[model samples]
Target: MSLLKGKQLTHYYFNTSNYTKALENISLSVEEGAFISLLGPSGCGKTTLLSILAGIIEPTFGKVTLNEKNVTETQSEMGYMLQQDYLFPWKKIIDNVLIGPKIRKTLDNQTIEKAKQLLKDIGLSSVIDAYPSSLSGGMRQRVALARTLITDPSLLLLDEPFSALDFQTKLKLEDLVSALLKQYHKTSILVTHDIGEAIAMSDQIYVMNANPGRIHQQFEVPIELRQLSPFDARKHAKYQHLFDRIWEELNQLESTSIG
Candidate 1:
């Protein structure tokens, strides 16, 4: 079943006397516990779509529904993880994880305990007291992930969360994130420019076209990719075939836009 749905999403930006359409009649549905990715070039409105779904931005002519209710009107049930870890330099790791509950005024003993348990579950128990500055990029992102999960969000919006990490670190975190999302049964939507990352992590990928961005095509990742770790998924025989297919589609979009 679809846990989240966007219908005829259209968004625009105004600058003094001129307006630009960032998204155009985009529509999508994310099944429960499924991982979905928005893949396209830099101007493809991927992040704009994500913000609209998160209720951070209102679409010019569409609506986002979560569980049949308008997401903008409902109480927040979404977690957003960005490209940067965004942890406060002065806050300890444990404290950072509790920020969500603290902001929502639900930071009680139970929430605190959950935060601690989440840190432990994410393999950061040994560094609970360490500050963000003391951790590696990957570790900080892990802490950020824990912070997002501590809130027990019904949906997750990931905007290139692993983009800043090293290639090796990105692969490791991809595996970790894929495992955690499945284990928690959280439906997630990731916005990424990396075709491989999208293929490895997503159950469905929406390839978008730029210049008034709209969905170009949709691809269902192979079932075998879902069973393998992200690194192993990269080596699967179908991986290259799928990658080349997406690459061609994206290239076509680019070439068409230029022409």
Candidate 2:
């Protein structure tokens, strides 16, 4: 059964007399434990769609059901990683990572032990006491990922989580995030403009178009299951083909927007 479903989602930004359609009839289902990526050109509704699904903002029209429960009126039952690392500067790394559980009042001793285990599992045990300001940009992002996973949500909503990092850091973190998600058996929906990143990280890619934003294409990757890192996925021949196709699609949209 699908873990999450979106039914005929439509969203718009309205003012006194202007109505800008951000999404129209957007619908998709995510299977349990599947890693899905939503790819789109700028001004497309990738973030907006994610927000709607995450219940950060309500859609003008639609329904979002997760694990067979309607949470459109409640706070999302999923963890969210914004484009920027939303870590607290003054909080120690462990404390910052525990924010989710703190808010939900689930940060008990057993959970704190699990939180420590999560940090250790991610190879950040040594930095557990360090503040966010003391860490490198990549380390901060790792902290962000740790923070999100500590909540142990069934679903994860990643909104360009690595957009702020350098290419090398981004690639490395992709491996880290992918492996962690697999280990935790969490289904994830990643929204990104970088087709290469999407191809490297996702089992399926949903291509979207803007200007009354809508899903334009959906591709179930045609590649053998490879037990390799995200860094290794980038080196696959299939990755190149998928990247080229998606790159071309996005470039076309950019050209049209320019003209």
In candidate 1, what are the lDDT values of residues 102-201, reduced to their tens digit? 8889999998888888888878999999999999999999999999999999999999999999999999999998889989989999999999999999
Candidate 2 positional error at 226, Å: 5.7
Error of model 2, residue 249, in angstroms: 2.5
- lDDT string, candidate 2, 121-207, tens digits: 888899989998899888888989989988878899999999999998998899999998888899999999888888888889999
- Lowest lDDT sum, 10 consecutive residues, model 1, at 69-78
Error of 1 at 238 (Å): 0.9
Off by over 4 Å in 1: none
Q: What's the lDDT for all of these models?
A: 0.93, 0.87
Please give the RMSD to the true structure for each candidate, in Å: 1.0, 1.8
- TM-score per candidate: 0.97, 0.94
Q: Which ranges of candidate 2 are over 4 A from the true structure? A: 73-76, 225-227, 255-259
